[model samples]
Target: MNNTVPEDGEQLRAAVRERYSRSVGPLLANQPNSANSCCSSDCCTPPSTQDVRDTTSTDCCSTDCCSTSQADPITGDLYNAAELGTLPIAAVLASRGCGNPTALAELKEGEKVLDLGSGGGIDVLLSARRVGPGGFAYGLDMTDDMLAIAERNRQEAGIQNVQFLKGIIEDIPLPNDSIDVIISNCVINLAADKGQVLREAQRVLVPGGRFAVSDIIFQGQIPPALRSDLESWAGCIAGALEENVYRQLLQQAGFTDIEVEVTRRYTLEEIAAGGARASIAVLNEEERRQTEGKFVSAFIRARKPAKQV
Candidate 1:
């Protein structure tokens, strides 16, 4: 609940890790039909920025994006009932992603795949099925609780083609040119250094490997005052890159044919109604006006071209 943003990379990483680790318990306890209730009518209204400035800590996730209970609208609707039927209920409950990367990754049989920030292994399990027995899927996550749950889900599913590794997305553990496809679900925006994450992704991919992910992107400029708040970063708001900047980052990472397709656009009203309401509610009327219709969840696609002869 600390209001101040972490000043250094290590601090930022620790804060994010702590937040996600704490979220696991609530996610497990959430019911199938539950929606994010963090900012519902029953909850208390958000305090003004000046009032919060005097407070020592603020639960940014509960107030903003960290809460992933059944009430969380952002994590739901990404999976179909048929897909949900194939995995443990716990896996489906643990999903905190914004999009279904496996559905769009175009995974082929016998292709090796990697998922960055593979929270509860839902996408990994789905990818394993798509790749069949001849292929393998690897999931990388930094949180021990999430990894444990993911492994438990993997066991429950009785799948043999998937393995979950412990690591940060910015510094992937895999070797270079070893993977055919890289996918992530709403995780890159959480990284302290997105450029490094992209670079690591590029380094691990074999030439011709595809980069497919779902993430939050901004279409217009966020108010400078809003952009500087670290609390918003942890909530998946402050960290989102502008659409063009996202493309340039991919280009800089040696990716070709970058495409960002919007899957869901968030309005200020929608945010105000969701788990992140407390965060958005703190904005003044003018700031609220600036943010409307600017943020979107997108499916980003790019490719590492074939190696030169």
Candidate 2:
């Protein structure tokens, strides 16, 4: 079946908002998940050539998409036990990222940090701790419910250095060249206008500031008929860009020293069983050839040029 949601942002954005809010509704209502983790779908690899389920939740949307799901292939156990222990249960449960950018970003004390889709504020809190009280961590999210949960998580953590902002990543509320670093987890792929997002990112980062983030990227061909349908595979994994395209976009946005490191790869299977919409969904043999071996969860790093003097 064909999906038109890609041509627009509001529909996909709304789906993300509603889906993420529901992921934490149980905990927000004082009822924790027995499993202690709610997960988003994995990346869009569609499984191996043998048609076997990869068991990776890496394809489409998730509750957070990047939470601590040990059983999930895409949204694997990203946070270590030590990292998990430090966060409030709500923060841990509300996580929805594909990678741990805060852990990977090499943040220094007193650095100003920003989390793009900072759902539930997992990375923000972690960065706050990493940067210490001398540093400030900011989380930017469009969802009110997610922001509310994040604020509560911040309070519970007692991180006075953190602030949660209500805004979309495409248009950050902060000033240009005001941030020292920017980070995101599996959230960039959700944006409909990726170029605009990158432009905004470049605008906010300070000279020599680092742009370290984790995201989903695709390579190879996706037939028009199935692209959005597969994207409907769910949450943040939707609207992924090709690896090379992502690099080009970064360069065009005036970022330098760009690097994309693959942390996990995702595969998809036919919609025969346990599929979101088995009957209507279509990713047959011809398409699977191009689709398989293409999706990956990556940590993309870049930097704004140092001041020219």
Candidate 2's TM-score reads: 0.83
Tell me the lDDT of candidate 1: 0.76
Per-residue lDDT tens digits of candidate 1, residues 1-309? 565556687888787677666666554554222323211211111222112221333322134422333243444467665676688755765677878999999999999999999988989999999999999999999988789889989999999999999999989999999999999988898788899999999999999999999998888877664455555665666677889999999999999999999998888766554444556767888878879878888999999989889
Return the TM-score for candidate 1, rounded to 2 decimals.
0.84
Q: What TM-score does each of the candidates earn?
A: 0.84, 0.83
| Model 1 segments more than 4 A misplaced | 26-71, 273-275
Clash counts for the predictions, in order: 8, 19
Tell how far residue 289 is off in model 1, in angstroms.
2.0
lDDT, model 2, position 268: 65
User: How would you encode candidate 2's per-residue C-alpha lDDT over 1-309 as one tens digit per residue?
Assistant: 344554567766776666667666765765443221114323221121112222343322222333323234555567775776677766765676778899889999999999998988889999999999899999999988789889998998888999999988889999989999999987887787889999999999999999999987777654454445533434333467889999999999999999999987766632211122332246567766676657777899999999877
